[model samples]
Target: MSSPPAHPALSCAGLAFAWPDGTPVLDGLNLAVGPGRTGLVGRNGSGKSTLLKLLAGELAPTAGTVRAAGGVGHLPQDAALDTRLRVDEALGVAGTRAALHAIESGDVREEHFAAVGDDWDVEERARATLDRLGLDRIGLDRTTGEVSGGECVLLRLAALLLARPAVLLLDEPTNNLDRHARRRLYAAVDAWPGVLVVASHDRELLERVDRVAELRGGELTWYGGPYSAYEEAVAAEQEAAERTVRAAGSDVRRQRRELAEAQARLAKRRRYGEKQAANKVVPPIVAGGLKRAAQVSAGRHRAVHAERLDRARERLEEAVEAVRDDDAIRVELPHTAVPPGRDVLLLRDLELRHGARIDGEFEVRGPERIALVGRNGSGKSTLLRTIAGEVEPRAGEAAARVPLRFLPQRLDVLDDGLTVVENVARFAPGATPNRVRARLARFLFRGAEADRPAGTLSGGERFRATLAALLLAEPAPQLLMLDEPTNNLDAASVRSLVQALEGYEGALLVAGHDVPFLEAIGITRTLDMDALTSPRGAT
Candidate 1:
């Protein structure tokens, strides 16, 4: 007799899923997530979000079984909490707490007693959970609208924690969170007791995981340790794959040379046989027999060389396929360079209606990179808009001496109806389509991909297209202002963006909550919008 297999915290066997249009996302996938923190990573459009939805029971798989030891809680990439929902209601304990209050007030209905059965300290637990998630000051009666977008995300996570599910799934939990909120969420992840699976591009978040699971082309590959370890492993694997490809390429070349040599020798032998046959150096029957034997020998030799060449070519193809193609953006903008002493932007006591208060003068000169950091609703976006000339400041002057462009958080610069090529052309009207396409190719939109409609592109691809438009515009922008640029980008796209920025020689003002990304892009200084607005309680 054999013992039964142990059940993991969560398991999926031969799972398959497809979109409504019959486009497959995951096919015949098998996964087992034991009790621990696991980081799920992949490129955009790789179905990380869809997989979480299936596991959370929000969507049914097209095939196979998904089993979990206990309840599952999932936080999606876009956690949309109703603005009017109260804190206690969002935590899922409003009914029970209300019942407790009613019972204490001498309204002892049987239903009220039933609602308040065993868990009488629900409010205490809710508050504790909220506190653990860094919402200590938040009142249970307050509505979600009173909090920031980052706070709303943490609030949802607190509710999930209150549920105490056996398995938790978080998708891009740190997307809009500021540094402080992200640190609190990281602590929560570190302290989670159940099977926690997070799909994120945040390097710091991934660093806390016990293991990394990479999903590529509908397949799951498990790597022990954190994101850094996974990157090292991947690098080693790529090195080996490249070596194999080189060896296979050499084998193919050798086989081709051997085949050519055999063909040449065979042709020479045929010519010799023809001459001997014509010279009548032997009897007619002997010459015929000799000619036939030589022909058979040459045919066998040629067939063997041809077969070896075919096999070599196949091996080379397989070797090449094993390597991952990480297409990166390559940009060169000499026109965007600003001299060291040149004034790029000047702001004089700019103030916005939304509590973003800049009481003093600020100027950006040369190729300086500045990070605009603040809590959500602190008017970082408003400040960027004012400098971009999209919004007028109420009390002061916001001016840009050099040519400037703004990349909004919502990516509104693009026209969804038009293709990416058309969008670039709109920004660079003087450039021909061929020239625009050639420039777009550097941003990794090669050939037909450049012709894709902006609406049809994935989040990362759309970012790239928007970036291409900005960089390829007429009289290239000397000052680039980006509002929460890394909000929805995948890790690969983030790296590509950094590389593009490295090539740019302009002044940068990027407002974002991603600290690692800011550091990676070489931010020279930081302006805290929260400090500027603290005196007025604006946000």
Candidate 2:
């Protein structure tokens, strides 16, 4: 059999990086990747993006070096495109360049040059790539400005695919993409040859990679195989580390007890020696020798105890480091009483629209937990807005028993200029300034942070602020509408939010892709948007 290939296509050696404010983001971090796919997993703010940028040659490391063997391509989490240009035109730039390069190098024969009939061929290729990404039937003549955010994402991917770089870096590629687009992306990734590194939180996508590398505290651990294998290995490692710490603790306790007993025995011997000396019942030399022996024994016991304590401390630190704390942000929604006879929400044949087509028709009742599941652009957001009274349905009547509170995916409900306390005050008008500050504190906003502008808060903080306002309302809204509430939340925050939702008896209509979270919060019913809206044989 032939030996496998050697030499990594990309490598970072002793890489160290820091932010402008002097906070260290990466500390002597080193990683290497050869051909094939590698999945990067880490808690939020773990420097995953910084490392990718370094590898892509977009950012310089403060210390050490990153090296890549071939052309590199990066698909940013949020890509900005020329909205005025059509999709074909945007992608044509790269295709044209490659064609020109080939022509200049005499790689194209006369016959091949003749076959390059018109620019439409290039546009066709671009459109085909987009189609493979589930953007089929979308005209190349359409302006990117008119495209949805999800389409923009697919366009970016199409551009990268056209370029066909030797190494690819994708950051959260599945984010904001609908299920169909996600499946398309997975298919493309599976077929692509060359070095590929993806940083994402999507378990389904990660499971497709050949290896999983977890980033924790500026260190990386690579586990061979898929996500499930990595998960099992991590679980076993944690269990072993915990057992080691426990055993060390027990040893320390045993050593302390033994030391105490030794001290007591030494004290008793010393007292007997001292009494003998006082009574002049023995020679002074013999009594002095007895006293010296007791002191020597006590010193030996002390030394032994110190050694055990030192070992125990080392073991405990090892265990602590082995099980690193996940730093994802979390939000806690406080429980509130629901008013009697409050018809939190009422929907009458509510119809949602996507472009000229009707997406779905549905009705919701008070205090219902409904999960909306569909492919991207299936009118989930439109449905939510119609319910919140933010958007009007073309045809149908919608009403809320009480004022409805909507938390968009972006958490834009709060005014960016207002401080955390001020935002909270807007929802709970009767709340005094002090009371507002207290409420914010319950969600981890305390001290002077309450006065900080909402725009300065992190993604997690913004979500918490929104939840705080909703829960602290004067007549607390019995109906809460959340769109992808768990997208940017940390593990801890997700857990807290789940607990709060479990205790909430009011109606909740959530549109999210987090299956575990949905199951945990007890989604009593689900609305399949695709089934309700599709025309005859549309699927």
Candidate 3:
């Protein structure tokens, strides 16, 4: 493999940032990024996006400095263009295109030639870039609002590629992309030769990076190679950390034992001296000297053991911190179980919005785990909402036979103004606050985290809170339908979702493009929405 560049393309020193409310997000953060792709990952709310913003000069640090080799290009988290602008304008080639067209005509203006400047093939390059990013079908004259959100992201990146920025910062670039768009972005990352830093949760995207930069507790930790390599290294480190903790724990216990034994021995010596003096074995002066010497020795001995025990405890604390196993979600929903031969869902001749139709009857029986897979704008979310009774089908009927809950792609299942506990309680009216908190704790939202307003939560935290509310509902969701469940979730939250599903014995219908995540959750059947909605489609 080629080594990283010798000189830094982007670097920051003693970087710090804080919210207006005085809550510090990042402090004394230092990073030096050279050539090649780097994937920045961490649990949600680790300030990865904030770091990218600082690097791109979108946000000024409360302290410290940022330096770069040349002009930096940044793709914002919510990248978009004015709906009225043409595709060429969004790609940053409108002016050049106009100039070239003017020169092509009989005008032959000097200013037009100057505007074109050596970039005579600008239109060709722009079209090529758009095609490379899976925008081949989207013509240059198309309006910005005509494309999907995912395509808009690609368009922004295409513009950057055409601009030829010295450094690029992509924040969750794949969050809005579909599988096809994501594949194109992966190819773009592979072809990029300059400094590229991407903050992403997509496993496939992280696997393409040359290095992994993890932001945890405001510190940057670097790992060589791809996502798998980083996981291996972390696993090995955690094993070593646990071993160190075990050894330190044993040492602390041993020190305590030894200290107790020494105290016992000192007490025995004092008792023997007193007994001898009482029995007149030594004169008064000799007895007094013996007692003073024993007192001094016992004091020193106990102090030594006490100090050793303190040191051992401190080591144990340090070792525990080194281990990286954060708290995981381990909720078991026995109440959500559906026995075999149960009819969980039924959809007969359903015609959803956007002219999508399921012409035949469809049924989900027992504890089936079905995956709804499709491209962007393929009506996956619409189908899920139809089944949940949130949206009316244009024709026919959709019904859920069992008690069910739907987790929409937006994760808008909770009341934003309410605390997490209160939201869960909203779904379970009879449950007490303590009972709600007890259930939330299983989803890793314990103590103050459970009391925090849902609006204040990170994306991952919001998912957890929504999940807690769903699974802990009164009748228990026997059929759970989730739409694009893994979007914008960190790796830890994904794992937590997997864990939650592992213990849930219910019918599940999850619509998403994350195939690996579907596999992880043990998807037993796959249904393609495109095939389901075609003219010859069936149940």
TM-score of each: 0.83, 0.80, 0.84
The residue-level lDDT of candidate 3 at 160 comes to 96
RMSD of 2: 5.8
lDDT score, candidate 1, position 315: 92
List candidate 3 stretches off by more than 4 Å. 1-6, 76-86, 94-120, 143-149, 176-180, 331-355, 363-367, 385-404, 410-439, 447-457, 469-479, 502-506, 532-539
Off by over 4 Å in 2: 1-6, 57-61, 79-85, 89-120, 145-147, 324-331, 337-341, 346-353, 356-363, 386-399, 411-476, 489-496, 531-539
Score candidate 2 by lDDT.
0.74
Candidate 3: tens digits of C-alpha lDDT, residues 1-539: 22334678899999999755455778999888998898888887678877888999988899999999998999976576787989999988999899999988867989999989999999899989988987888899999866655677899999999999999999888865778888999999999989899988887889998899888888888899999998998888889999999999999999999999999999999999999899989998999999999999999999999999999999999999998866656656655778988999988888886567877788889999998876665677788988888888899889899988898876778888888888999998988888888888887888767777776565666777887888778787889898877776776667877887877799999988777889999998777777876535433
Q: Mind giving the per-residue lDDT tens digits that candidate 1 earns over 1-539?
A: 11112567898999999755455779999889988898999887677888998999998999989999999999977676898899899889899999999999999999998998888999899989888877988899998866766777898999999999999999989876888888899999999999999998888999999889899989888888899999999999999999999999999999999999999998998898889889987888998898899889989998999999999999999999999995656655546778898998887777875556776667788999999888766778778887888877888888899988888765778998888999999999999988999988887888877877776555566777888898788888889898878877776667777877877789999999877889999998888888874323222
lDDT of 1 at 323: 96
lDDT of 2 by residue, 1-539 (tens): 01223588888889998754455778888888888889888765566777887888887789998888889999876555687987666665544545645776788766445545454356567767888998886776677765555567778888889878999999877766777788899999998898999987777888998888888889888888877888898888889878887887787787778778877887887788899899999899998887788788878877887787778778777777766455432344444445445456555555654532333424455556888777666667777887787877777666776655788865787898888888889888887888787777777777866776775554556778888887787676667888888765656778888988888867788987677988999997887656654332122
Provide the overall lDDT of each model, using Cα atoms, as 2-decimal numbers: 0.84, 0.74, 0.84
Q: Count of backbone clashes for each model?
A: 0, 3, 0
lDDT of 3: 0.84
Give the C-alpha miss distance for residue 398 in model 2, angstroms.
Answer: 4.7
